[model samples]
Target: MIRSGNPALKESTFLDLGTGAVVSRNAGAMTLNGTVNRTGILLLLCVLTATYTWNTALTPTGELAPGALLYILGGAIGGFILAMVTIFKKTWAPVTAPLYALAEGLFLGAISAMYEVKFNGIVLQAVLLTFGTLFALLMAYRSGWIKATENFKLGVVAATGGIALIYLATIVLGFFNINIPYIHESGLIGIAFSLFVVVVAALNLVLDFDFIETGVEQNAPKYMEWYAAFGLMVTLVWLYIEFLRLLSKLQSRN
Candidate 1:
């Protein structure tokens, strides 16, 4: 049975489902960095889109310009397509990963620009802190400092689901005047929530690692590499946004 804590599965490392080939545990295991490298081409596209959207603005003169809605739409559509591709691993990841990245880039850039106008400099700080957190999480994972256990997985998964529900509810509440307190600018509550989210996001990396390791061990198809990258990108995007929102909330209070 394919279970999370299968010892036999853990004993052997790195099986290519494409070829039914198995390699030593320490020999061919796919590392997170390696999977990222495989998807670098797609990531570059995302970066370009972000840069282009970041600079495209209405300026103080107020000429015709793409509004925040455009960025938000592009990001949403891209993310939807990305999820589709990830779920249908055979045909989507290879084709849509790059496009998804591009869309996200444009969205993040535009969002960052808007925030910059409102909060000034918080964007840069958020970016730096996001990367810092990513680096820290990766290092800790690699060093075996934070072991991924069944309980850890359940906690993060539950927290993530709760957060998603809250976000969706908040969005729906926008039309009714019932705002989600402590989410946007409720001071300490917002900060506490953000911190909890950050912790959950960081813990997601552990799940990501487990998936990668499991895939490699199970001999999942080669195309899964792109799918795996897509998953990582999704988590990273989430982490970045939470970081940005938390920073914005904190800055707004100051």
Candidate 2:
């Protein structure tokens, strides 16, 4: 009954795919250290790919390099596909997770570079804020300062779902030549909305931490280390994007 607001780390994430069985202790079970180490590996892979894409997407002249959009689109689609595959086939996470990280890196790298062109120093600011929030929340959660109570989870899940619906509506409306006002603007309303979203996104990391500890306690299979890492990466990516959006909104106000 492990629950998380992150869609990737849903309830029953560590349960056997079809057997409805719990992992045995001798089955090379998931460990906190192992998951943490694998998370580092995935982060390294993501950073490597992101750096490459950033270099390739932005030329020395500060203009976009050719095929930049391809990197973005390819990464977006490819990362989505790989993530779905990994979710449905958890055993394949040892392979698909790394691929997913690389693809997402490409997508994020290109997007961040473009943002840098419009708002110099924004990318670094976003990265710092993202990781800073991560550490701060982790410390808070580990020290019992923040607990993922049922009410907290429900609130975060509801907020996340609302945000998803808003994004979906925005996309659907775009098809009809309609644009949502204020939400995407740099005005006070937009900034407030972005700040709220950022807080929710950061709160998700708390759920992620609680969820992963539950997985380890359940003795999820060793391969689940990769799956767990993937789930955490998904949250981290979302958080980083929200920070970017929030920072961009604030910068635009200047």
Candidate 3:
């Protein structure tokens, strides 16, 4: 059984979809190539929408335009809702997943532009590092250098859960005007914490890879290609955001 640290791509995601379901022979079973193709499509949609928000967030003077926050909030909240919908209604992924991507792109582009405005060239650095980590880990996983052992999956899942709890606590405490001390600061401990989160996020990609491969092997429904791609996109988005935060922290110190 394949297990992913990503909540969307759980171990049971592909189970039993192959056995007694109504599958169309002409539609074909899920394949790695199909998933890759759908992933590319979703990414293209994301990038296109992202460019819209990215441009909208800036003025000719290169200053942040007013009302950018509207776009950001809209994207964030809309994406969250669509993501929940897609998570529960996997069959609607062909429609909702792309919508989710577009919504998330708006959020990412706005946030990235804000980071770039403060720290010149930080967005490019974060983007390069994000994709670099992705390809490197993909190569490692393919080359058998990194195996998704049971223990590894368990550790990553646990670490991911802990990180989630930490972020949750931090958010909750924020209402009380309390902060998590150095965890969000630019101190050494904060940098270390960000670095650790980035590593765990990267490892989650390996689990995603394993899960997608398992889905293919299990003959999961063809629409699962889109769902699987959506799950991968979720991880990539999280990784990119973490990279942005880490790079910003590092740049602040310099």
Candidate 4:
């Protein structure tokens, strides 16, 4: 059984796809290469939309361009709704995944611009660190240096759940103007918190790798390639955001 920390990817995501049923003449089983190609397409879509919002966030005076907040809020909410839809209807991933990527790009671009404006070169640093960590972990997982053992998966999942609960509580408490102490501060504790979150986010990718491989081994439907890719993208987005926050916290200290 495959278990991942990503909410978008459950243990049964690829298992209940009528594995024993006859496949249509036009449909092919999921493959690693196919998922990789679809992931590339989704990433391209994200970069295209991100460029638009990144440019839009810039202005003549280097201040936030008009309607930047609109893009951020629209992207965040729209992406979230689309993600939920795709999670429930896996078949719709071919269409919804790209849309989710685009929406996320808008949100990421605006947020990155805001960070960049305050701390020069921070966005670039965050981007490089994000992808660097991704490739490093991919290599580690591929080389068998970082196996997704059952215990490891369980630990990561538990930690991820705890992190989610903390974030949820923080959001709820915001209504009362209550902050979670040093967790959001720029001090050592805040940086440490962000670093821990980033590590957990990175570890989630190993589970994602295991899940996608399981999907291929199970001979899931071709559309599942897109679904699996979507799941991976979800983790990557979360990792990138945490990297941004961590970098910002560090920059604030200097």
* lDDT of candidates 1 onward, in order: 0.68, 0.91, 0.90, 0.90
Per-residue alpha-carbon lDDT of candidate 4 for residues 79-128, written as tens digits (9 for 90 to 100): 99999999998889999999999999999888878888888898898889
**lDDT score of residue 122 within candidate 1:** 80
Supply every candidate's count of residue pairs whose N, Cα or C atoms clash at under 3 angstroms.
3, 0, 0, 0
Candidate 4, which segments miss by more than 4 Å at Cα? 16-27
Pairs in steric clash, model 4:
none
> What lDDT tens digits, residue by residue, belong to model 1 across residues 36-89?
786586668777877777767536653325576688687877767766655544
Clashing residue pairs in candidate 2 (N, C-alpha, C atoms within 3 angstroms): none
Error of 1 at 37 (Å): 1.3
Using all chains and alpha carbons, the TM-scores for the candidates as numbered come to 0.82, 0.97, 0.96, 0.96
Error of 4 at 148 (Å): 0.3
Model 3 bad stretches (over 4 Å): 16-27
Give candidate 1's whole-model lDDT.
0.68
Q: What would the C-alpha RMSD of candidate 3 be, to one decimal place?
A: 1.7
lDDT leader: 2
State the displacement of the C-alpha of residue 61, model 2, in Å, after optimal TM-score superposition.
1.4
